[model samples]
Target chain A: MRDRTRRLVFLALLVAMATALHVVEGMLPLPLPIPGAKLGLANIITLLAIYLYGFRDGLTVALMRVVLGSLISGMFLSPGFMLGLSGAACCTLVMALLLKYTNCFSMIGVSLAGAVGHNLGQLLAACLLLQSGAIIYYLPVLLIAGLPTGFITGFLLNSLLVHDRKSGILRDLVRT
Target chain B: MTRADKILLAGLLLISLLSVAVLYGRFSIFPAKAEPVQAVITAQGKLVRKIYLTEGVNSSLVIQGRVGPATVEVDGTRIRMMGAPCTGQVCVKEGWIGRPGQTIVCMPGEILIRIEGAAPVDAVTR
Candidate 1:
């Protein structure tokens, strides 16, 4: 019971941190050269979730972050909201699944996969809604951006996991 | 390689292909000419045409809906949305638009401002 409680507490903290990072990113006044690119700070928590609690937990946290993050940011139903939600969900799922089974793959490999998937999902959603389909022109640009951002987030997550070592949520939860 | 890795790799490949197809179809197959577009402004499935801004010497402006009929003022290469019944007054705030992809949307009055570029080649030929 103690271990379960501790793990739950850790998960809640992760989710809260993820939400705060998402909101801060949305609110930041950075003049990103591209219209829709960022460091994707919330993705750190997402990557952490994947390493700590398996695929489903990572997915749940990511989805929650997107929905809540958008609502809080007053971007409900806007292109930005849809883009964030779809990209985060797709990326988290793919990364988690790949990492769960593959031992040879490193952080960089997972990052590349996640970044590519993220862009694809957003582009697909945009094509369906915009009807003009002109948005796909932004893909190559988004991929180029996603590659570097994904690498940075993946690297951060790997370091966090390495530092936390066995005391992470995965072990704590498995005890219950 | 495990069955799972192969499956994941295959899925990734499929996603990449789809992305390429979408990018190709959007950029290469479509004409880039900006043309006048007539969009039906619908609220809960009710069609209402209010304001349209197309590029031309003179364009007819319509603002007919539940609120009231408002006069549209046109300047060279631009259209101004005059009076509107919407609370936020975003439609009126939109002032003038001459660009190809500009828009003014009044949710309350179901008014939409659409800007289109030169007529499509097919339309021009016809």
Candidate 2:
């Protein structure tokens, strides 16, 4: 019972931070000239959850963040919310599969795969919503932009994991 | 980054370059024609309204977007998004588009404004 409560608290903390990052990311204008392209900073926490607690918890965190963030932003049940849902679903699934199935993939490989999956998923949703096949042409630009953004998020998560290992704060609080 | 990661990144870059090359070829083969006559607004891929731009007349138009109403301005032959309900404001930032084939898309609001239909050639031009 005690351990379960601790786990719930930890998950809540992660969800809160992830939601904040999602909202904050939406507010900032991306330096990249491409419309709708972002660094996806909230994904770092999702990756952490996957690495620590596992894919199920990671999925939970990603979905909860999207729902709460969109609701807070007054975008609930909108096209943007749909895009977020598809992106997060694809991203988390790809990262989890890469980590679990592949030996050669470290965090970087997983992150890159997640980024690609995210763009493809969101574009698919956008195409469906707008009923425009022409949007496929934008895929190349999004894929190119994903390279750097994915690497940065992955790199940050890796460094954080290293720090967490030494500090053991999270380790003591949550049972994996 | 692993050796496979480097290889994967390189491969993705190559694919993107190839796609861009193909897209460029397609674009060059069929250039975007100019001299649009009407601004067509669509929400969630469904036609909402079409406003023909009259000569020397200015007007404001609105369409129901996902979040709220998206406002657009039409002036003579030019059209631009005046205010947007979407957070990105990408549609508003697209500025004025006076030619056919230009579009302002607000993905968040599920709104797409496209300038289409070429201006008719008068007797002298014909």
- Name the best candidate (by DockQ): 2
| lDDT (Cα atoms) of all candidates against the true structure | 0.70, 0.84
Model 1 chain A is weakest, by summed lDDT over 10 consecutive residues, at A167-176
For model 1, residues B1-126, the per-residue Cα lDDT tens digits are 334434544665566466656666566555556544543343333655533444455654566655655445565567666777657777778887766566767666665656665543343110
- Tens-digit lDDT track for model 2 on A90-154? 99999988878887866777888899889888888989987976677788898889888998898
Give TM-scores for every candidate, taking all chains together and pairing residue i with residue i.
Answer: 0.59, 0.67
Model 1: TM-score, first chain: 0.86
Please give the DockQ score of every candidate, comma-separated: 0.06, 0.25
Instruction: Compare the candidates by TM-score and give the number of the best one.
Output: 2
Provide all candidates' interface root-mean-square deviations: 8.7, 6.7
Q: Candidate 2: which pairs clash? A: none
Accuracy of chain B in candidate 1 (TM-score): 0.45
